[model samples]
Target: MQGPPITIRLLLLMLTSVALMTVDHRQNHLDTIRAGLSLVVYPLQYLVDLPSAIAHWASDNLSARTTLVEENQQLHARQLLLEVRLQKLYALEAENARLRELLNSASKVGEQVLIGELLAVDQDPFRRRVLINKGSDDGVFEGQPLLDAYGVLGQVVEVTPFTSSALLITDPSHAIPVQVNRNGLRAIALGTGEAERLEIPHIPNNADIQVGDLLITSGLGRRFPPGYPVATITEFEKDPSQPYARVVAEPAAHLERSREVLLVSRTAEEPSP
Candidate 1:
């Protein structure tokens, strides 16, 4: 039975809602009842929202973790690059030091000198030779003298347009004229295919040579300049039955380790006294 018109029913419902709101706002008469209703509905509301809350939390945490990992990897890569650069800087410092030594030696020789870098070392055990970057194009010629900072290294044996080969003083086929610095007794130093050994053959049994004597170039053969160091006497042996004494010397130049060397000019000035 429709006892009331639509307009009358709407007005009555509005009046009832306003009366309940006024009472709840002033006297708080519906507080307990409202609280009980909220308690009953809270679990349903949370249940409906749980999936979205979980999704938001997981997305935020996972994204933050991914960002941190990426940043860490980038930092690690940068550190490795810096370390490599540092190592290169160290190598450059050592190279500069070696160049400085070569320059000083050049100045001491008081001659026109050209600097050359070693390209390759001879692999043959019997040949102690090295290839250099300087060649005939750079005024390098056969029999040109090569010297390191410490002493005479060798002489150029072969020259090309862009490269040259040097026979080290330790090669079995190499020989240099050297003299004792103490008494000026001249002798020939012969290589033995050993890095550290040079033999002084034809020394008389009564020769005045002694161990620890410095051997310098004697300006003979006109190949190497005078007064340049060659080696130091290390061992001397005399056999009464033999006319010559067996003498061994160690090279002054670091043949096995030098990376740069100087080539003396053909008309080079005399070395400093």
Candidate 2:
């Protein structure tokens, strides 16, 4: 009662398929019947493929959204980076302009001049001083003249190994000899502890000075070189009680805003015997 041998059964089925194919080829058998069967099974075939179609659609939509989101984030980051670089470029342009002016002004000294950057500013009320980066190590010494792009800034009063302190012309204790650029009238310019004011202690009533006169270093002290600008005569008034004329001058240097300064390497000298 066992089934026929496997090889024999396979051979029999193959022969039957061949016979059916020969008959169908000759007589067009099963043509109408096959059409009817396909019609009946078409709905089932479509039903089986629906899940795959929906899954493919969901996957494609999710992938596109994720890609768009990633691209948007990358674009935003790139824009921010470019903005930061542009700001830095603008700042550099302004700084370069300032440096060019400083170099041009230093040329007036006509002596060996060293450039120094500001380090710190004192907040003390009594002493108005600033520290520069160069010091004794850089050939800076006491009484070394400091100049900005506009005019004389200050003079180095103290020097350390790597830094030096400068006393601005606006300090109360500082004094410089100045002369009117128009007339040879010499006078002492004294700091008034004010940023914009310097007081000339005693100007004779008959002195040939007027508003708008440019003040230049007289070089009498031998501490500063000759022909450097100091301040401008802004006001002059006469008081009946006071013997000296009241005069106020504004500093030529941008004392509060100077970031870089030049130090004249000229040595301070004394009159020879």
Candidate 3:
């Protein structure tokens, strides 16, 4: 029993001496000894790490097919959804182009029309203006009229080198001359800063205008073209003894929601006086 205990003690002492020598050689001024020991131990390090590397490679190889299949399915579904949307967009664009062509022909004024894309709406809800992707270079001028496919949108308020700002007809400061299409009753449609509505001020209480009457630009001031749709009478209130009637009309064009518009050039062919 004494002999076995002495042998175990000697083994422990030898292991502790080796660990101390390794630490000193690696950390202190013994590079030559450290390099030699590293070369001897390098094979064991590789052997320990080899199983983990092999397992990782094998796992990737086995899952590659399933991963590819799932990715392919997702891509195909996205492609199908985009294709359907594209088809509808194409049809809508074609219809818009045809209607614009007819409008240009019917106007007979020969004004060169430039199509502009809406860039942004004003951050202030009270101000009804939009930024467009056209400017002086595209023949857009300040005070030039803008219109959508349905009717008048607004006038150019600010012109820049690359873009311009349009004040919509619903702006609080905007007003346009309009005539009721039903009975040719002329009135001024004033913007109330409401999103899709305007107010007709100073109309007599017994005016011929009805709740469903259509209002079109009368072209009296020549700011807007005549016969262009402006608004539709939506609400009207008349007090028997009041001096003026209270009337509200909804705009015919998608003033707040329109994404595309035509910037009518001010250079329309003038007829001889």
Model 3 Cα lDDT, one tens digit per residue, 214-256: 9998977766767888899999999888899999999988786
Better by lDDT, candidate 2 or 1? 1
- Using TM-score as the measure, name the better of candidate 1 and candidate 2: 1
Rank order (by TM-score, best first): 1, 2, 3
lDDT of 1 at 74: 100
Q: Model 2 TM-score?
A: 0.72
lDDT of 2 by residue, 1-273 (tens): 999999999999999999999999899997999999999999999999999999999999999999999999999999999999999999899888889999998776677799999999999887789999998989998998899998888899999999999999999999999999998789999998888889987897767889999999998888777788999999999887878899999999999988989998873344311
The parts of candidate 3 lying over 4 Å away from their true place are: 1-110, 267-273
Worst-scoring 10-residue span by lDDT in model 2: 264-273
Q: Which pairs of residues collide in model 2?
A: none
For each candidate, the alpha-carbon lDDT, in order, equals 0.93, 0.90, 0.85
**Candidate No. with top TM-score:** 1
Q: Predict model 3's lDDT versus the native.
A: 0.85
**TM-score of every candidate:** 0.80, 0.72, 0.64
Select the stronger candidate by TM-score from 1 and 3. 1
Per-residue alpha-carbon lDDT of candidate 1 for residues 133-203, written as tens digits (9 for 90 to 100)? 99999999899899999999999999999999999999999999999999999999999999988999999
- For all candidates, the clash counts are 0, 0, 0
